[model samples]
Target: MSQQPKSSDDENQTEMYIRVKRNKTTYFLQCLPSEKVLQIKEKLQVLIDEPVNNQRLILIQTGEVLDDSKSLADQKVENDAAVALTLRKADNEFEDVNVVKPDDYIRDGDGGSNW
Candidate 1:
């Protein structure tokens, strides 16, 4: 089917495509320049199952991370811009105490074991 060409005014009003890359996957996200960085992360979370807090979007050309407090327009992000996706590591400092050993338990006067 043939489609009519969009007018310049219509084109200006339409959302632009932002290419997102993660490993070998590429996602073309429709974004408005006025949208906040956090909004973009929220969109990515729904599309790719990436947690919003864990996502780190970097500009492919400049390697600059998108600031959560700024709008896309503030960064001068234009249409058809490419972004690389990275994930923040989970909290590895948490000690897993699920498997308690005998040595980990101390006996009190009442003969009760305490962790």
Candidate 2:
């Protein structure tokens, strides 16, 4: 039997996940591509005790500053995308992108030799 093609609306409604990173921490968020940036920030607010207004999200791959008024789809943020989360500082300036990779982690042993 042949399967039916998925409609655009169906694709938009499909559950997707994105990784929100900050420093050495990563937050995997379940979201639809149709969700707005502000919505994502609100979700992050729950996990992090930070206000949405103090948070800024940037697409890691494109280095594009995500607009709170725009949808993830509109920003071309697809499934499994990595987004960097930065918070406002005391001076009211957004912090720099500081996503740390696994390679940056320092092991207790020298040269990562377990043998």
Candidate 3:
């Protein structure tokens, strides 16, 4: 009697690929079969310069912000998962405020208004 061949599932397991987009650049993250979303975020922190806690990352498909407490496995992150980094606007109002001193308006050799 001949023996049956093993199924492909038994021979090899497929790995999930996570895609991260930062500053318009796309990064591919190859995760283990059991890796969590938080684990992936940790890896991303190393790749980007921004602080991990302050940085905003969203799921491309759902446009939902990734909760730090959640896991990638829980989110059902699978092959071709697209993750995007959203930059937060600076809170300071002075960022665009320009201050011009009175001296800046003085003309060459022009004295103050003569009475």
Please report the candidate that would top TM-score against the real structure: 2
Error of 3 at 100 (Å): 38
Clashes of each: 0, 0, 1
The whole-model lDDT of each prediction reads 0.76, 0.94, 0.63
lDDT of 2 at 52: 99
lDDT of 1 by residue, 1-115 (tens): 9967977655544578898876657788998887888999999999989688878887877878889889787887789998877776566232221223355455667465454
Residue-wise C-alpha lDDT for candidate 2, range 58-100, written one tens digit per residue: 9999999999999999999999999999999999999999999
How close is each model in CA RMSD to the real structure? 16.1, 3.4, 16.1
How does candidate 3 fare on TM-score? Answer: 0.58
Runs off by more than 4 Å, candidate 3: 1-14, 92-115
lDDT of 1 at 82: 81
Query: How accurate locally is residue 76 in candidate 1, as Cα lDDT from 0 to 100?
Result: 74
lDDT per residue as tens, model 3, 32-71? 5456566776777788765565465677778777776676
TM-score to true structure, per model: 0.65, 0.84, 0.58
Candidate 3 worst ten-residue window by lDDT: 92-101
User: After superposing candidate 1, which stretches have Cα over 4 Å from the reference?
Assistant: 1-14, 91-115
Error of 2 at 52 (Å): 0.5
The global Cα lDDT (0 to 1) of model 3 is 0.63
lDDT of 1 at 12: 48
Q: Please give the lDDT score for candidate 2.
A: 0.94
